[model samples]
Structure formats: C-alpha cells, structure tokens
Target chain A: MLLQQQLDGKITEQKDTGTPLLQVRNLKKYFPITSPFGRLKGHVKAVESVNFDLYEKGTLGLVGESGCGKSTTGRSILRLIEPTEGSVNYRGKDLLQLNQREFKGFRKEMQMVFQDPHSSLNPKKRIGELIEEPMEIHKIGTKADRMERAMDLLKRTGIREDQYFRFPHEFSGGQRQRIGIARALAVDPAIIVLDEPVSALDVSIQSQVLNLLEEIQDEFKLAYLFISHDLSVVRHIADEIGVMYLGHMVEKAPTDDLFANPLHPYTKALLSAIPIPDRKQRRERIIIKGDVPSPIDPPSGCVFHTRCPFAMEQCKSIKPEMLQQSDGHQVACHLYN
Target chain B: MEGYPLLEVKELRTRFSSEKGTITAVDGVTFKVDYGETLGVVGESGCGKSVTAESIMRLLNEKSTRYDGEINFKGVNLLSLPEKKMLDIRGNEISMIFQDAMTSLNPVFTIGDQIAESIIVHQNLGKKEAMEKAVEMLRLTGIPSPEKRVHEYPHEISGGMRQRVMIAMALSCQPSLLIADEPTTALDVTIQAQILEVINDLKEELNMGVIMITHDLGVVAEVCTRVAVMYLGQVIEESDVDALFASPRHPYTRGLLKSIPTITGDRSQKLHTIQGVVPALDNVPKGCRFAPRCPYATDKCMTEFPLLETLENGQKIRCWHHQEIMEREAASDVITAAT
Candidate 1:
C-alpha cells in the first residue's frame, strides 16, 4: 500500500467513527507490595480513578511532581503496564478488555516515545532496522516497502539517510531523540505518548525538538499525551492540562485557564512554584510542606490535605469529588467544593 | 586584604588526560565572588561550569587533570598550596554541593552521621557534640522533625530532604565560600524554591560569598547579585543580574534566555534557539567558541578569538560583532519607524 493511501485510510476511518480518538474513564492501576516471605503488604494505588478524553490531533499535558503517577497514567493508557481496572475506549473499542493477543492489533495505533534516546533504542540493531521492525511485525508492508518508509520517516524527522546505517551511539543526544521520534512515527500511530521527550536535551535542542514535534503534529494531525514535570514546557504545547497529585487527577482545565486562574490548592502551588526567568515577575511562591506520602500507604480522604494549607475537618475525612466548573474546568478540592 | 575579593579565578584552565587525548575542558575562565554576595555561573552542560567549580576546589586528581593559572582564596593563591593545606580548605573554607543528591550521598550512613562526620573532622568536636550539632544544622535547613530525620539513611529520606542534608553538611563548618553546583536540578520546582530560599537565608546570615553554578536563568535572577554566562569553557558575558536579564550582550546569553519556556509567554510560540549543539570537549572549536552556533558569526568571529571586553555598563562581552549588532538593531528600528 502507498503512504498516501495509508494516510487517507486513517482520514476515512476517523471520519467514519464519531467517537473521540481515545476516551479513558475511571482508570485505576494498583500495585500490591509483597514482603520477602510472600505476605501481602499494602496496595500502592498508583493511579486511582483517572478520567480524561483525548480528541484527534489534540495534546493533553499531564503535570505533577516525581512519583505522582503522571508517568504511570501514560503507561496504563498504553497498557504498557497492566492497568488493574478501567475502560480505555480507543475509538469506541474498549482497550482494557482486550487480551495480550487482541491488544497487539491496537498497539500500532498507540505508540510511545521514551525519555532517554540513548537507552531506548536497541544498541545491537542498526537505526534503519529499529524503525522498520515495528511495521515488519505489524505486517503493514513488504521488506523493501518497509525500508523505503523507514528512510522516509528518517527524512521527515530531520535525520540524514546515511545515518540510518549508523548505530545509536554515533549520533548526538538531539539527533538520537529525532531517531526515537522517527521510530515512533514509523507505524503512523493515531496518538503518541511522549514521556519527557525533550527533558534530556539541552535548552537550545529542547526548543528545536519541541518545534519539530509541533510541526509533525500539524502535518500528521495526531493526538499527543505530552507527559512532563516541566510546567513551562507543557504550557507551550499542551491544549488541556491535568494536575496529578498522589494518584488522583486533582485539577483539569484548558492550558491558558489553568495557568491563569488555578482553583485547586495543589494546582495553584504547582503554578506558583515554576521559576520564571524574569526576576521582575516577582510571583509569590507557595512551598508545600513535606514529601508526597508513600503510594503503598497513601493518606486517607484528600491525599493533598497533609500538604494543603486550607485543609479543614471536612477535607481530612471526605474525599473531594471533581467539581465541574464553567468551561470544562474541573478541580477536586474542598476549597472549591 | 583591604580590596581583595573573597574568591577569584584568573585565567583558570583545566585539562584532563583521557585515553583519547588531553582536552582543555575549562579554558582560561576568570570570575570573582565577593564577600556576602552570590555570583551565578550560568551555562549549559559541557560548558565547563562544574569543571571550573571543581578546579577551584582542587577536587580533580592531579595525576590525570592538570590545572593552569591561579585560584585566589582570601587574597592567597591556592594553586601553590600543598595537598595537606588544600585538604584543610576543602570543607573548612570552601564547600561544594553537587547535582545528584541520589549518588553524591552515601546510602549506608545515617544522615546524622554524615553531617556530624564533617563537623567532627573540621570543627574538632567530639562525636556526641557533633551529633547534636548535626541535628541543629538539619533544623536550620528547615527539615521537619530534625531529631527523627537525623536517624534516617540517604535512601530513607526524599530527594528534597537529601539535598537539605547535603546543604547542612556543606554549611556545618561555616565555610566562607560555598560552590553549589546545580543543587536544585534534581529537585522539583517547589523544593527548588525552598532550597534557594534556604541558601539565600544562610548566605545573608553567615555573610558567605557563594558561587552558585546552575543552568537555570530563573534561579540566577532570584538569588544571584551578579551573573557570569559561560560558553565552551569561557566567560562570554558577565553582568549584574539586572543588567544581564535587561540587556544580554552575547548572542548565546540571549538565545539561552529565549529558549527557556515561560508560562508568561504566548502558548505554543516557537522559542528562539541557537542553531547547533555544544561541541564535544575534545573537538572544541577554534577562535570564538560559539562561532559555529552563533547567528552573528562573521569572518573575524570565525577566524580570531574575541577577548573578554568590558562594556560601558560594566558588563563584559566576548564577541567581535557586538558593536555591529547594536548598530544593526538601531538601523533596523530606524527603518521600521520610517515605514
């Protein structure tokens, strides 16, 4: 099949289906801790009831501190790790219900670009083979056709054709990342989960990579789950932003609105904490007290209540449900409730 | 000592002999940190910021790493100092906190033992007295329940807590000069803010000259009194924090500032980025180091190395075409006005 025909197939397929590209509802992934003696310890509620919708060509940015289940959410959505329970409605198909054999079919449409370019790619394989292997496994094209598309992907990702024969170690960090992006784009995925794609690169290279991602997004019309701890970086690309705390989606809103008027205490704290380059901005920073409670034994009621300044008696007992405000801005906090 | 700076590096060069070859990582970099002020040394990775700090501390093995030029501490040239004297200066007068809290700290030792070890070694206090002092130092760093935290190992504590412990250890001996090399990089934003505040408070209280080495311009603007922007192991630009942010002379400085994604900027706006990556240390470019990546590179910039020249506002710039750049900007503005 021709590249143009494959692209048109996607267009027709999207047109045929009225449902959102990906609809994740009440996604819960829990990991049970076991002692050395095989005794049941506690359950780490890594992702507790994560709900969000991703449209075609839209980018949803997940922002949180380290170990806040932002990365876990992306992995669970891709089913890279087994999500304990949830309905991952990928274009009307419930992805979570599918077994390993069945999930393999959906794997082509949902791809991932990892953080470290150096370690992500298999060292033994040539760069060309790395990109070609995915399509070869999916049986999308013939050997010659797959090779051609891989080279095309290399060119589209701004990598030289000659470098495709080179090993991963030969290229610079930025160039290696381009190869990673090229590999992710090889399958013509509908949505890509980019986990800290630009964090490992330098500031100059970060912008370059970010610009490339934006251009690619425009050209391919693909949705992106841009997961990063950098709020500023996320603000630049993300349309909708979700602030994760412990294991819950504390706040969800449009990027501009969230940055402008953050309702949840955690969201407000997160926004205020970002160090603006301009000293003259003089924004008052809200430093939350203590570390995030261990996921194996998370705090009761509101997980953020221990660190939250406005925590009251109600917050310490009853968990605050996500209250929908005007214009799809939802915040889960007792203060808002 | 009347007019002397607290710490000053004059034409400092650091070279490491590896299997490949002897590569000059930090080439003739010079800067000064005065008493009770923080001098922010800002640069990207491989720009020799950390190497410069390490050179000042004499942390590199003298066998493999060769140092040229002078490192003056309290009006005394430390290059001539013997290993015995240098050992005394390491934690007593000069202290460094590195980037990674996870690896920099010993996982086996309790937090109290580590902090107290530094105290006992430098201050000559008994283990019992040093242990008490360790708790005091932890408390000063704003660690909640220092008594409990002191008993925990490096792994038991969080990243932010480990960093706090590192700072407490660095400050235990009342070091006049603190070289914090990316202290907040491994931490979250809120924790970074906290760490910066703690450093600021301690700097003021002790009146210690701080050499804050970081890649973050935001941290520089917040904490530093003066800033030195380095590229490929040389100080390309040096100005007061206000002046550096207000009017960055070097193209690299401007590019870096613009490259930083800010929440204040228009969403999804394409950031201004320098064309190329930092060259490998072994493959350092001749002439102006930034010529390859610089947009303003001319024949002169490519051929001849630009000397660090102090400008009218006491801002230092190392660019052959900075004057021409200003003139061009003026001309372009006039042209736009005429239109």
Candidate 2:
C-alpha cells in the first residue's frame, strides 16, 4: 500500500471508532548552531521525519539507543521543543498550528515525566507542595482543593499521605520516582510522555514502576509515548513499538511481532545482542562490524547502512521508504522494499 | 580444576569509614579465576562487585578504607604488600579497566603516550620502544590504523575506541589478571559486543585471568567462564557458567537470571522480577540479607544467615533452603513454562 493510502486508512479507521489521542506525522526537530557572531549556523537533525500514533488508551513504545532522537521526539510532540517541521495532531486539532492561548489549554492534557527522578523533582519544596504547584500553575481550584487532590494523587501513587510534607531527599530512589509520577498526574493529563522513566531504577524496582504504569493506564484510560533504550520494559508495557536508528524510525510493529520477526537488520542485530539468561539455548550472535556513525552527517541513504550486516550498494545511495510488509509491521529497509 | 588458577580471592571484605559509620562494602566474598578464564561478577548496584575489583587492585582511599582478607595473585598476598611494592604488582601483574573510558583516560596525554607510560613503568623500555609497543597493543585491540590513532587524545576517539585504548593500556604490561568493572556499560550494544570480544581475545592471547563485573547477565553469559552472584556485599552463589545458569542455587541468583529479558523466547511471558529492592547498608537484615525479599524464605532463613555450603560438583550456595527450593522450582517449571 502507498503511504498516502495507509495514512488515509488509519484516519478512516480512527474516525469509524473514536479519535486517537495523539497523532504525529513527519515531525522534525533540529538544533541550530550559532556562529561566533551569534548568527544561525547549520542545524543538527536531532529528530527527523518521525511518525507514530498513540490511541486513546494504548501505549506506543519509542525505543532507540542514546542520541537516536527518542527524547527529542517526545519533547517535540509535547511542544516543549519547537519542531523544525511536521504536524502534531492531538484530538483532531493540529497542535503545531495552535496559538499560545490554545496551546496552554492543550498543555493541561499532555504532560511529561523525565528520566532522572532525583533531578526532576525540586529539592527545596515539600512533596505535597511540589505536586500542588502544577495545580497552582493551571489554577485548577482553591489552595485547599489542590492540596486535597495532591494528597489523593500521592496516596494513589503508593506514597504515604503523612509523608507529604517531607522533602524528596527523604525518599528512596523508587519512592522519588513515584513522587515524580504523582507530580505528572497532578494535572490529570490524558497523554503522558514517559521519557526513560524506569531506566534510572534497579531491575527489581523497574517492575514495580512498570506495574504501576500499567495500572494507571488502565484506570485513567491514558495514552503513553514511552521512550526508552531498554527493549524488555517496552515489551512489557507497549502495545506498539517503533525502533529508531540515527534519526529515523526504521521499524514499527506490535511488540510480539517485532520481537519474533524483526525485519530491519539493525533491529535484528539489537535483538541478537540481548543476553538471554538461559545458557542452554545459545543464539548465534550477529556481531555488527562498526559503531553508529555521526548523526550530524548520517549516511546519505539508509542511516543504518554503515552498521547493517546485509547492506547492499543501493542501500548506500537511496533512502528506503517505510513500507508495510505485514499488518502493523512496517520497515524502512531496501531488503523490505 | 584443570590447570592452576591465576588469581584467587579468599574471604575478602572491603570496608569504608563513611560519615554514617563503618560500612562493609564487600563482605566475605571468595572466588578464583583460572588463566585465560573470564569470571563474571553479577550483582545489582551497591552489591560490592566493583568494590571487590578495587580491593584486588588496592585502589580504594587508604586513609578511610579497611580491607580484611587475602587477594592472592600469582602466589603473592596483594593485601600485605607495601604501597611501593604494590605499585609494581598493580599494572605489571594485575590491571583494571574502569567503566567510563573517557573519564579513565587522561585527556592531556595522547592514547599512545598513555599506553606507553604503563610499558615504561613496568618494563625498562625507552620512549621509542614503548611507543612501538603501544601501537602493537592498540592494533591487538582491533583498532584500525593503531599507529595513526595513537596520537589522538581521548576526546578525539569514539567511546568504543577510547575503551579499546583503556584495554591496551591495562594489558600493556601483559598482566596475568585483568579486572574490568562495567567496561562497556556506557557504550551502545554493538560497541559493547566489540569491547567484550576485545577483552576475550586479549585474555586468550596473554593467558590472563579476567574478572568482569557487570549487572547485565547477558554480557556475563557471553564472556564469563564462571560467575559469582553477589547480594548485599556477599557472594550468594558461585559456580561454573553453565551450572549457574542451568540451576541457580541462591534465590537472588535465580531472580537475577529470570529478571533479564531474554531476546530468544516469547515476549508475552511476564518477567519474573525480584519483589523488593536491595536493603540499605544501615538497614541490613538480621537474618539472610535477602530473606525479606526471597520467596522461599522460612523461619530458619529469617533467624540466621546461611553459611556458604559446598553443594554437589563443588557449587557454592549461601541458602539454607536451596535443596527444597530447587525441588519445588523443578516441579513448578511445568506450570511456569506453560504460562
């Protein structure tokens, strides 16, 4: 199917049912360099033509290595960073085209939980007051009303209400993360961009946060663009997974489908490298030859061609279009093309 | 086992005097590494894996640090050696590669000069001879155009190249033992594999004993000949690589093995994560340190910590209920695997 037809089909599908909470198309964010004279220099392609959709009650796992534009994509969608190009359609309204007043209204519905819990939360403020500040910014209710909601959110996120007056340093790593989650939930956002929310956590505590995320998703009917480098957590939480390389989405498929039959060579290499605990079932490790090339001057055609084990000459000259090989399985590889 | 072990650590305890109190970072840990063998140390953060490596090299701050145990490297008690004597043994007999390659490498010096320093220090080689040896070491580490790359600073090279340089400097003396503490944790997966392969090749070429410390079990499976599973600063389990993976004797080890997401199998199955977090140093459990979290903990397990007992095939286990737990787990595998 052509790209236009696939997009139209998705729109009709969403219209036939209910609208998707968030839809992103060709979103690009580039960091501009300034010359010594403070003139705008060439831009760095932090995120490039990324496309994905998060339904009303589903999680879309945006996964890649560090500097693969996962965080930039999240920040761009939330409009925390201005995109150099593309459309962000949230609830049928193009968020990219929204004015400041309109964008402020949309901000209440979209929130972000950052990677580092230790640095994300304010050290000076009490836990309750920190959570209440969001409500204060939005001017949602009276001071007493905001505190009551803050206490409810704190209790909901598995923190003691009595400890609400305590500082963030008083809590453990896991608890501090929970407080971060509570602060994000204070605004009652419909969509949450969880940026490496559990990467800072221990493996044992990671599961707890994951379980909590699942529970919150179920209860509030939340949509998440879960960005992370860890594939295991994405498999556990996301319904759909987008595998990014350099600054492009190389593959997007259901978690199970992507895991079972990864189409892209880069995806295959990544999967093969993950160490299975069981020693009996040894995998033929596909050792990719070289390191990831510089993103500023990414390879002309397929960004992954440099490290791709099965790269052809054509892969070096022409960019492969994102083509659907199966239902919900799209890959941008010359082999697939 | 087969040939003589190159390095052996017996009942090693590394303590530090913190502002809070005297804390034992590594408590009564013991393991051995045969020549040309990679013994992986697997544990969570603050589980004493790094401290064990630091203790072997005597790298901790001496004023606030206290060590109680024997680190017998090539028949010499590294603990009893004087500071001046240890300087000879450090890079010449036993070397270490730290986690962050960028921070570990001196920014002011070129890669060649850094590696050459070790050669000059350990061997009586002149600067020119040391430079040639440095290029040889860099080339051995699989770096392309080692001679050209040697003159570049640490910042000039990629993370992978910097790590290779670190490996080159560490093995410049051809140390019988190499201690790597999360060497590839900062690099991407592809680079991580390369670093692991580099370490493996060097271990084989130099006939060196390698102690690899990492939290990722997958890396351990790929490289380690034997594994010592540490928890709360103690070696909870120690066995051959295959045996440890096949039948983990300790609950912590079992949980760690299960917790790692296997790329080979079905993705639908829920990962068996260990329930609770690692207890803080001051809040050490009165009984088994893992008793608060272990699913198989009983009244006996809650009252006293189990001694490290030698099981069949010389596998060491620090759990009182290992026999019973193994039996129950075997029976439940049918149900667990189906799910």
Candidate 3:
C-alpha cells in the first residue's frame, strides 16, 4: 500500500517538473594510494567537482575515454563508493548526508546495471531467483507475489517465461543483460545507472538491448545514468550528454546540440574520433594527439590542455569554469571564453 | 610470381576437434589481397573472422585444429609448406599484429629488444644494427623520441605507445603481407585513429597487402579497399568497399549495417535489430546458416543452401533472394525519395 502511494505521489509530482529527480553538485571521488605499511602516498582524483541534474524520466549519458572517471561519477551518485565531497540531492534530499540506515530506504529507488554480463551474474543462481532477490531483500511483497512479479519482469524484458529456471551460463550475453535489466526493474527503481551496458555484445545484439532499454524506460518512466565509452551508443540513447576528461566534465549539453555544435575542444576531438561507417561521408577528423594522462596527478588548470589542439598559455594555468554558451549547453574551455 | 597476388586464400576450411565434436570455424572462405591493398573481413563474435586470420597465419594448435584448401602467398602454397619452411616465411615474409598489444609483447623485454629480435632473426643483422633499425621502425610509426622509448619496458609505456611498439615489431622485417586482427579494438577512439593512421602510412610505404579482421564496419570503411561479410563461418558477401556500403545485397549485411547507431544517426527512430542471437557452433544450421535470423528468409532458403554466386558488378552474395531484395530496396528508395 505504501509503495502504491509513493508511486501515485511520484506520478503527480512528475507533472510539476519544478525540481529534478536527482541533482548532483560538486561531486568528487578520490582514491588514496598507500604503501605496503599503509603510509599515505598520493590520491588518484578519479572524479572532481562533477555536477548534473537528471530529471524524472530523463536519460543522462556520461562519456569519455578510459580513466576519464565516467564510471567513478556514476558509482559516486549511488554512494556505492563513498564520495569524498559534494552533494547528491534526490528529490530535495541529500543522499551523501544520509546515514547507512536512512539511506537503505532510498536504495530501492536507484539501482545499477553493470557491464560484462558474463561475470556480473552469478553462474549458480537461476534467472528467476536473481530477479526476486532484490524484492525479497526490500520486503515489498510475499514469496508468491515476488515470484509472479519476477515472471512478469522476465516476460517484459523479452525473456521466455519457461526459461526462468535456467542459469545465467545458459543465456547469451544479450540475454544475460536483459536479466540484469529485469533484476534492476524488480526493485522498481526511478533511476538506473548503466555502466557500459552494451559494449560487450555484438552490434546486432547491441541494437536489441538498446531498443529494450528504450521500451523499458517508457514503460517504467525511469531515468538513466548511462555511462559508456562509445559515443555513438550514447548519442542514440541519451537526452543529455556530459563529456568528461581527466576527472572533470569538459562539456554538457543536449545530445543533438552537443553533436551539432560542440563547443569544447576536447568534445570536438572526441566527436571527430568516432569512425563513421559511410564511405561517402568521410568526416574531417580532429585526431587528438597522445593518450589520456594519468588521473593521479592530472595536468594543472585544464586537464585536457596537454592534448587540446587549441590550448593557449592561459589554459595551462587557469582552470576554465563550466560557462553556459547557450540554453542548456555548457562547456569548460578557455577557447569558449 | 609476376602475375600472382601477394596473398590469395582459396576455398579455405578450418576445423577444430573438441570433446563435443568437430566445428568448422572457417568454412570454404576465399579472398585475395594484392600488394598495397587491404581486404577487410568483418563479422560479429563467433563468426570465425579471427579464425580465418589465424588460419592464414597457421597460428592455431595443430593437434586440435585442421586446415584444408589453399593459402597461396606469392604463388607458393603456405598450407603445404613444411614447419621449418613455415617458420622462415612466418615473420620474415608475413607478420601479424594482434588486438591486445600488452599481452602480445613480452613484459620483461624492452620494446627495443623485442623489435630488434625480429629484425635480427629475419635480416641476419647484428644486435646493435637491429636495435638501430628497431628505433627507426618506432620512429616510422610516429612515436616521439624513439631512442628513449625503445629502452622502456611494455609496462612503462602507455597503451597507444605500446601499440605503436607492436606495429614497430611487426613491420621491423618489412614483410610484404601483414594481418592485423582487430588491432585497434582495445584502444580508445582517439588512440585508435592514431594507430589506424600508423598502419595506413606503413602499408603505403612498404607496399604491403593487409588482411584486417574486425567486427567494426567503421574501421572497414576507413581502411579496407575491399570487404567480405561473414556469417556463421561462411563469407556471405564480398565487394569493393564503396559498393558494399552503398548496396549490401545480403540480408545479414543489411541488418548489420542498420544495427549500428552511428554518430550522426537519426535519434527519433528505433534501431533495426537482427532477431535472435547467433547460433552456437555445435548447433550449426542445415540450409542457409543465416536463414534462422534473416528477415527475407523464404521456404526455399530454409530447405536449400545458397551457393556464393558472383553478380555482374563483381559482388559475391550467398543469398538466394539477393535479386529480389535489391529490387525491394530500390522500390523502397524510390518511395522514400517520392515522400
């Protein structure tokens, strides 16, 4: 009854759109390096001052190269890895400030779908049991009710009802990912943090999963924090995109706006790097020089200054703040300034 | 060797004997690569694209793996070559760069030592001279300060640099044929572009024939002169790169093209996905291998296997309904244009 009431309240509240479902501000996650004897070495600043808002039923894509801390930012929002600083406001409540007992109540509202379907699901457990495990922990329904709901979720996710008893090992990578999605939906989450969800699957399988995600997002009215390294995949799903580089959000804009008129140099280079399949439409690629630097001791000021083709003297010293270029388009680059 | 192609694979069939049964990984695959040309073999996972490359290089374990058909390199049959003769031709006449550079390189040896080892063995050069050539190869790959980077261990350099070193080592002997199996799959997009550029530059300089085996069509479009689409261990389609992308005759090829969400793709419409997963190697289909997943599969497709027929435009298609599909596509294109 309480869950129904919460759902009803959310439906009414979503219409107003006054505040975001989740508002992240100045989020930072730093991992400390230590010697064998536990002497403090240096901190690997994985995420620094990341900020974004995920409205109800919206999709936010976090994209970057490896070690760009896109995954770190996603984890930090859920407090899966405790954030070193900043606030994660969910419906006006700060998640970072909530204690373990207090946060347990909110955990059901947000769930995560991990990458690598092969390793993520336990080999021994049946697919049905995996979906029901979340509901059983949350104590939402009785045993019979949970089983029915699990079956419904499995059916909705394109899995056969008869195959519910089969183990994860029996399913393909795409099917395993559907099971992962079904399990996430079991808790009835408002926001799902998907980390490189389709990168492991083939292109044909990837499209199926992508389509399934879109369908589920509409049915459940769920928001997504889609974290991936593939720009093309992100472009297809995300409403808004946040481009990160060396633990900082270099640019954030609506998907179409970002791709059409990318303001940041890093964003431009990243956009151009994607090899388009069309033989006729060969793009003028920006081909940025060198690899991403180590995030432990990132370059001063702009982390991307070392790689930025338009890097100026000021870019090496003074950090560029996220300045709004136009409506809903923000970029952190000295060139924009 | 006057009129012979640099590398020509004819009716190649590679099978592996497992505890369950024998599975044909590369079934009757055929293609050719001339000097200064790239032939791209593209397919999804478990489609035997990698197996085809490994078959060409004869890298699979001989105890469990069996090969049939001809792998002719400059008019000489590589499949018939003795093990001792194969060793002489393997790295010296033809080299391969694998997907994972870190795993492919020796962790203990410096990049210089590794590259020099191939040069020393192949060119019969002195250790010092081979090391100098290694640095030159590294420099040719566009790695900055090759002299300093040459001495660094595999772990000491970045992923992009390590890949450059791998390319350096592969090209140190200046092989006429190079087989790159998903060389840039593990790399970041920016780094991938750099590596692809290096490969293209080197290919031109050496006038080498390259066999690029990857699942990514984007890479195929960027580098390949010709492309072969594979499905369930069979080459479904083969054409010039331009013709392949412009008009993919096979249903699997069409499905594969529509499936990928390009950077500039229309976001409003849902992606076209190929129904059903790839069948397991053990459960190989009887008739058309792709008939189970094909949208255009007919009763005839399910009952009889289609031969890989060559079309008038030099395109090969392994589908019974290729003509009908082309006509339907043309009609649809006209409708779209009228709208």
For every model in order, the fraction of real contacts preserved is 0.68, 0.49, 0.81
DockQ of 3: 0.59
Q: Is the docking of candidate 3 incorrect, acceptable, medium or high quality?
A: medium
DockQ, all candidates in order: 0.54, 0.43, 0.59
In the range A223-328, model 2's lDDT, one tens digit per residue, is: 8899988787787777789999888999998777899899999898887776666778787878888677777778898898887778899999999999999988
Candidate 3 Cα errors over 4 Å, as ranges: A1-17
Model 2 alpha-carbon drift over 4 Å, by segment: A1-18, B1-4, B264-270, B333-339
Give per-residue lDDT, candidate 3, residue B63.
Answer: 92
- Find the candidate with the highest lDDT and give its number: 3
Candidate 1 lDDT over B187-248, as tens digits, reads: 98888988999999999999999999998888898899999998888999999999888878
Arrange candidates by lDDT, highest first: which order?
3, 1, 2
Candidate 3: residue A18 lDDT (0-100): 67
Model 1 CA lDDT for position B200 = 96
How do the residues A1-337 of candidate 3 rate in per-residue lDDT, one tens digit apiece? 8545544443443244567999999999999999999999999999999999997767899999999999999999988999999999999999999999999999999999999999989898999999999999899899999999999999999999999899999999999999999999999999999999999999999999999998888789898999999999999988889999999999998888899999999888888888889999987989888778888889998899998888899999999999999978999988888
Native contact share for candidate 2: 0.49
What is the lDDT of every predicted structure here? 0.89, 0.86, 0.92
Off by over 4 Å in 1: A1-18, B1-3, B330-339
Q: What TM-score would candidate 1 get against the native?
A: 0.96
